[model samples]
Structures are given as structure tokens and as C-alpha cells.
Target: MPERKLTPNEVSYSAAISACEKVGRWQLALKLLDTMPQISIVPNAVSFNAAISACEKGGQWEMALSLLRQMPHVKISPNTITYSAAISACEKGGQWQLAFSLLNLMPEMTISQNAVSYNAAISACEKGGQWQLALSLLSNMLGIGLSLDGTTSGAALSACEQVSAWQPALALLDNMLSSQLLPNGLHAGSAASSLRKALGDSAAYELLDKLRELWEDNSNSNSNNNYNNYNNNSNNNKQPWEDSNNNNKQPEVRLWEAGQPVDQQLAVPPEALAAVFDVLSDVPGVIAIFKPSGVTTEEAVNELSQQLARQRHVSESVDLHIVSRLDHPTSGVLPLALGAVGSTAANWLEAQFAGRLVRKEYVCLCEGPSLGLTGCQGNVSTPLHTVELDGGRASRTEVSPIGRQAFTGYEVLAGYMPPLSSEPLLPSHDGEPGATGHADEQRPEGPELMLLRVRPLTGRTHQIRVHLASIGRPLVGDLTYGAKEASVLSSCPRLFLHARRIELRDLAGKPFVAEAELPHELEEVLAQLQQVAETSPEDGHQS
Candidate 1:
């Protein structure tokens, strides 16, 4: 195959032309256009149309328009596609004047009128907000006996939304059905969104019923028996590896061979140039000639329905997910880990955590050197916040103090609150001699700190944080509720929060527990605070 060039035939030019178009190389396309006639390559309408399309894609709108002006001199008449691409170029360039003018003049120029041509014109008008003009053109399209396609209908509906024309939107929806075009969710969304934005929340709320009804009806009629039969392949209703052909060994490609419009391009767009791009890579060219055998329009629609059902199945399956997201942190946020064990596992996990049947421990700063709030931040009681789930239910969170909380019965590891702490001095009091002396200062008003092996009876939101704050003692740095001198107590830089541990009953009701360490940040802060408490008697407030 010594590069058998076909003497610069239209086919060769078309291939080179399309390649240039796909890559957005307008200069190369123009250069190739110059070379076509050199090798006796007569420039047909297809050749020029492709070059124009290429130019449009390259953002050479003026150049593409120039090419159109040059169409008549080359003894080539602009076809529907030629004008369509030209109009599309004008639309893309935001040259609405040119776009509208060309569309109006198409008939006089004796160019054809097709769905693509109509779609481009309507979209331009929509983009330009020429609602009245666009509507007039759409009505005129019907007057000319060209049935509106989904593209036309969808654009009209979109324009309706852009212009805040809900009445026209409903009318358009009715027109879509009357014209036998199926209105999809995008169409419905446009109308609904417009209504919602125009009307208040209450009015928006009412549309939900109509939306629901339309969606149900649409879904029911959307699929054929073929899809239903395929779905029945499993009683489980889960088909990960499904499709008539599991093999993607070969793909089909489509090439526009001649004056004929590419069939693949004419029909619904294929995901790839080939029937399959990935798995079916080896397959030959696409189904180019698409009279579709004996497949009538209705049958084509049915097949389309089948394809859509499969795609929807894929879309729906992909959409199915288990996610554990935290709504807000301060109120308490659950780590995304919460969703991993869901449904039955989630329910079981919730039960054991709520029961708090499992024992726990925390190394807290007890205002004692032995207590060593170092690395072991002061412990405070906190509860797993109850989360309102879909059905208005609660789920428990598993947490513990800084370290491990194990064993059924709790035991204190170490630490104590310094006794004889200074109490708040009363302003009116006549001070006693010992009370006034530095050696005999009153004890501090707040409760002393100590290490404790406490067990929780229940899990509630902010249970630990709130409970500790409530008991005349809060974690050294917790300020969410209220901690004594918390605003200035920068010792523990963190809120003393930790997932700490989780406890739950296994399938057999056998208890299981997992603990996470106090992250280094919390540990470091605790170490410094404990050291301060040890050095000064007043540090622990020895009165």
C-alpha cells in the first residue's frame, strides 16, 4: 500500500477536511481547500460544508461567513447543513443579527429547512432573548410543515425559562405532547425552575405534585418490554455485568464517505466515533448507511427507549451510594466513616453505642502532677449527639476520653483535684487573720480535677462536652458552652475533641471496641498544661 492517494478526490479531501475540522485547525483546512482543485478535486457542497463547520469550530466565524459568500461563485449552492452551520457560527460568535437574518433568508436562498437548521435559529434567538421573534419562527416552522424535534422543543422551553414565560412554558409542554415529542426532565426543570423563581416558596411547593405526577407518567411510558425483560435477568434486581453483549472486543466507526450526510451524525449521537470506543476497539467502521433496514420511526423510538433504559439503569446504579456526611461541626459532626456500616450494620452499631454497655477510660488533667494532663489532656464527659435520620430516628456515636476505655468495670488510673483550693472571696466579708495571710488563702470556687474511669449510660449529641460543662467543670479549652476563664485559658489549644473509641455488639452480641489515640496536637497541649500545674502551687490554685 504505497500511499495510494486517490488523485485528490472529494473522498480524500473530505477525510482530510473532517480531520482538520475535528482538530480545530482552520488554517490547515483552508490550505487543504486550496489544494482540492489542484488535483481535479471538485469542491462539492459537502466539502465546503465541512470546511465551514471546521471554521466555525475554530472560532473563525467571519472566515466561515466569507466561505458562505464564496459558495455561489464556486457554483455550489448552500444546503440545509451549510446554512445551519453558518447560522450556528453566527450564534456561537454572539452575532445574533447575522444569525437571525440568515435564518430568515434561508427560504429565499432556496436552502432546505431541517431540524438542525431550525434548532440553530431558535437557540440563537433564545440566547439573544428575542422571545417573540423566536416564538414567531417556531410557529412559522410548523406553518411550513416541518415537524418540530426534541431539539426545537427543548430550545423553545429553555427560551421560555430565560424570559420568565411560565404560561408559554406550559403551552410549550402541551405543544411537545401534541407534536408527539417526549418532554424530559431538563424541559420540566426549566419550567419548574422558572415558576419557582417567579413565584414564592408556597407556589413553588405546589409544583412538586405536578412534577411528581409528570415524572411518574414519563418513567412508566419511557421503557418498552425489551428493557423490562432484560431487567428480569436477575431476581436480585442488580445487574452489574449486563447488556446483550458483555464483549466490547470490537467497536464500530462511522465515516462520512460521500455526498450523503453521515448517518451516525444524522441520528442520535454515538458516545464515540465507533459503536464502542473502549471495549469494542477492533470493530470496523460505523453503521454508515442508516435506512435502518425495516426499522420504522416508531421502532427507532422503541430502540431508543431501550437504550435510554439501560443508560438510566447505569445512571441509577451509579447514583446509589452510602454516604455519611457531617452537616455541621460545632453542633457535632459525624465522620464520613459512619456511612460505611449502614442499613443493618448501622442499626446494630447504633444499638450498642447507645446502650454504653461497654466500659471506657480517659486520662484527664486532675490538677495533680501524677495525673499528668501531659500527652493525656484533661478528660471531660461528652455524649454522641443524636442525629435525626430520614425517618426521624437517632444514631449513636462511639467516643471515649483521650486514651483507651475498656473493661466492664471502670477503674481510676491516677490524678486528683488539689483540695483546699481558693474559694471565691466575698467582698463584704471581714477577713480572718489566717484567711488574709498568703499561706491561708481561700480555695478556688471551681471543682478540682482528677483522673476517673467513668462509664456513660447513653450516647447523645454533645453529651460529654455538655455534661462536663454542666458539672462545674469543663474541659480546659472548651468554650462552645461555657468553661471557667476559657477565653484566656489557651493552655489546651484544642477543644479536647476525639473520636477516642467505639463500642458495639457484634452479630453474636459479643462486645467489640476500637480506640483512636489522642492526636499529637491535643497531646502536646495537655503536656504543657500539666507542667504548668506542677511548677506553681497557685497553678493548681493551692490556697
Candidate 2:
């Protein structure tokens, strides 16, 4: 417009600033906002709001607040939109206190608070790891007559999930139902994850079934009222296990009866347990299965034992002795002894793990390009202490001097760098800003990942996870020890640690080895990384 001899006014400047905000060009937006006043075009609240929103999208919280403060100096009173954008900027920056202060200040400034403002504050608390404060803000919103929405409830649920507050997470879901807000897959998934971590796989499965039923009832009601034809059509046809956003269904396991043909057993449809437990090795007294992620090790063993008894028509209770165990999210070789608990075979198998005579190798994808890791091979000797959380509902391992001794050997396989980009490759949240219903759902930009072959010499709770994180390289989806990196790479479905190989003596004292190939999902992630690497320049680096 200036080149055409027409001086751009505040309206034109605001529009241009908004255009920059959409593309996350916060610096350019601020520059344009500054230039407007130089040309005798007095900036208005609209101009400042656009610039503030631009900063928010760009994750420049300080600059956003600076713009907000300058608005008052320029005789432009900050309005609801202005404060909301500023608060959201703080949320993106992980500055929960500042976000809450801004929200509280709004009412004193005569700027009425809205759902957007409250959502931003609540999300900030979630990002800041303040679940209690997030819940408090959520309660305050309801007390002040602000009706709950998916965004509000999702943020609160995410906070509870992060802390493994299953009770509160379920309460929040119930609240969403009472408020007539249909919980999405993300909401249900977060609550299920919390239950899984705090209770067990059975509890999570039960919750999913309950939520699915509620969703179906709500969908039927809406369909009868002609509320949303598209939603009813699209959702009604989906399977009970399928999530709307994520279509991957949880695979099931089918246990075979004794003397059953291998081919026939494979042909049987999955039942008994809702996971893929591929039998790797079955000896006289030792049985090893590839335990898929999302099912606890104990749950897998118990279910398998019960299935075996039923198949054999045994009236007595069947108990499988667990020789080795893995975390709920860790997938791979899990060995169980078929002999009685105190039998010679069971004692021998347990002795191998207890005495560190067995060899266990794991492959994991961890946050990297780490300078500290240095070579192709390295070892970490750290004392790890497990601390109970939420009154023993959960626990986490940390490196401490007074903790139990733990050692891990690691060999770097490959490093995958993300494509170079000035802007984030993934959205900060799923649907909209501050609408991430689960902490594990948000996908912020992350550094390169290092695929490593790790061997834990000393068996301790979270040994490998804590050791790697102690050296500043945390696993991709380990929220307990590496919450920061896990949040950055939230696209990871679960913890990227897999038991690739296990070696121990069998019943006859012969050397036995069981190996499990990497799961298809993990392979897909690696394939995408390889594709990106081949397409990008060798020197291309994340900015």
C-alpha cells in the first residue's frame, strides 16, 4: 500500500500482523507493529493483540508480555483478547506462575475472564508439572459459573495423568460427562494411562470398556435428536478398541493348548489376553514370551497361566512363576518358569536373575545428539534410588549417592536427526492451542534421537532409564524420569525401550537365548527417520 502511495492505517497493519502470527513470524510481526507508529499510524488494541498472539504462537512469552506492557504505555488498554494471548504465551513457555498472574489480573483490570483465559492458565499448570494448581484453577472456573468444555477438561485430565492421579483423572472425566461435554479419545486415553500406571492393566481395560459404552450411549442420544449426523455415522462404525485420532487397535494374544499344532495355534483368533504375546521359546520348565507394550508383566503371566489351566482342563489353580519382569510400557522377552514356585527349576531360573548371571539386552530410542555420550560404546555406573510417589501409588528412580548401585553398558547404533526447520514440525497440541487433553499427546519439537543397545548389569527398578537420563540422554517416552524430553517427543506411543535379547541357562543347564525383533510401530518410526535423513542435507541441523 505504501508503494502505491496509499498510507496503511491501523486496520491494514493489524491485518498484516495477524498474517505474520498465523505463520509464526513473531519477530517480523513485532517489527511491523513498531513501524506503524513511525508512519504516524497510532497503534490500537487490535495491533497489539495481533503482535501478542504472534509471540504466543512463536513461543516468545517474554516478548508477548513486553508487547502487552507497551500497550498501556501507548494509551491502548489491554482487553480480554490481549490478556488471553499473553497468558497463552506463558503457557507455551511453561511459565505457569506468570500465566496464572495474568489471568488473576484480568478481573482486577475489568477485563472479564473467559474459557480461553482459564484454559491457558490450566494448561500452563499442566506443562509446569503443577497438577494440584491446575485442578484448583479448574475448580475456580466452575465455581465462577464458567461452563466446562473439552479443552478445559482435557487440560485438567492431562495434569492428573502426568502425576498418576487416577482418582482425580476419573473424577474429571465424570465432570466432563456431567457438563455435557463428550470426552474425546485423548481424554479417555489419558485417564486409562493413569489407571494403568497406578492400578494395573485390568483397571485400564475396564475403564476403556466403560468409556466406550458411555460414548455409544451419548452418540445414540445425539443421533436420535439429529444433533450431528456426520459424527454419528463416522463414530458408530468404529470398533470399540479403536481411537478416533489413532486408528491402531490393541492386538490380542491367543494361548495354545498342550500338544496343539503350531500352525493351528497361530490360526486361532486372539482371546484370553488383549495383547500380542508372541511365544519365543517354550522349554520344559522355562517359557519365554514377547510381551507387547501396554500390558504389565505380571498381568501377562497371570493371564497366560490361567489360559494354560483352562486349556488342559485342570481343576487346580495354575501359577506361573515370574523369573524376570519388565515395566508396563516396555515390550520384549519376558521369561516365566512353569514349575512350582519353590521347585528346583523355578529356584534355578530365579537365581540367574538375582545373581546377575543372565544377560539381558535392550534397544531404546533416547533424546540425543548428546555430546556426553561421546563414543560408539560407553557405560554408566550410577546409584539409583526409587522414590514412592502419591503415597506409594507410583514410583520413580533417580540417581543418588545413597541409592543402590546400578550399571548399564550402551552401544550407539544410529542417530536420527529431525529435518532442519525454523518452525516446529508438529503442533504444540492436538486440535487447538491449550487443548492438549493428555501430556503424552502434545508434540513439541525435539532434538535428534539416538538408538542404543543397552545392557543393564545390575537389575534395579528403572535402572536403564535412570542411568541414561543421568547422563542427559533420556528415553523418548519415559515420562517418569525424562518428562521434559518425553513431552517434546510426545509423538512416541510408549517408552522406546525393548528387551531385544535374553540369555540364561535352561532346565537342563544348556545355554538358552530368546530374541524378539523390534515391533512394527518402532520400525515405522525408524523408517520415517531414515527417509528424512536420505532427503535432507548431511549438514542439515535442527535450529
In order, candidate lDDTs are 0.47, 0.70
- Model 2 lDDT, full chain set: 0.70
lDDT of 1 by residue, 38-145 (tens): 867788888888899987776567988999999899999888899999988876665767888988888898777777777888877876677777788799889989
Error of 1 at 236 (Å): 45
The digit string of per-residue lDDT tens for model 2 on 1-543 reads 868999789999999999988776788999999898788999999999999998887768899999998887889999999999999989877689999999999989999999999999999898777899999999999999999998988889878877788778777866665565655656766676666666665556555544433444443344332212222234344432335564634321111112211111111122433244677887655778889899998888877777766765787646677767899989999988766654434555654554345789999987733322213577777666675543345677767643554678888676666534312332221232111111121112345567889888778888888777766667888877764533445667788999999987665445779999999988877786632132123344432
Model 1 poorest 10 in a row by lDDT: 280-289
| Model 1 quality (TM-score) | 0.43
**How many angstroms is residue 504 displaced in model 1 relative to the true structure, after the best TM-score fit?**
34
Q: Give, for candidate 2, the lowest lDDT window spanning 10 residues.
A: 252-261
Please give me the total number of clashing residue pairs in predicted model 1. Answer: 34
RMSD of each: 25.1, 20.4
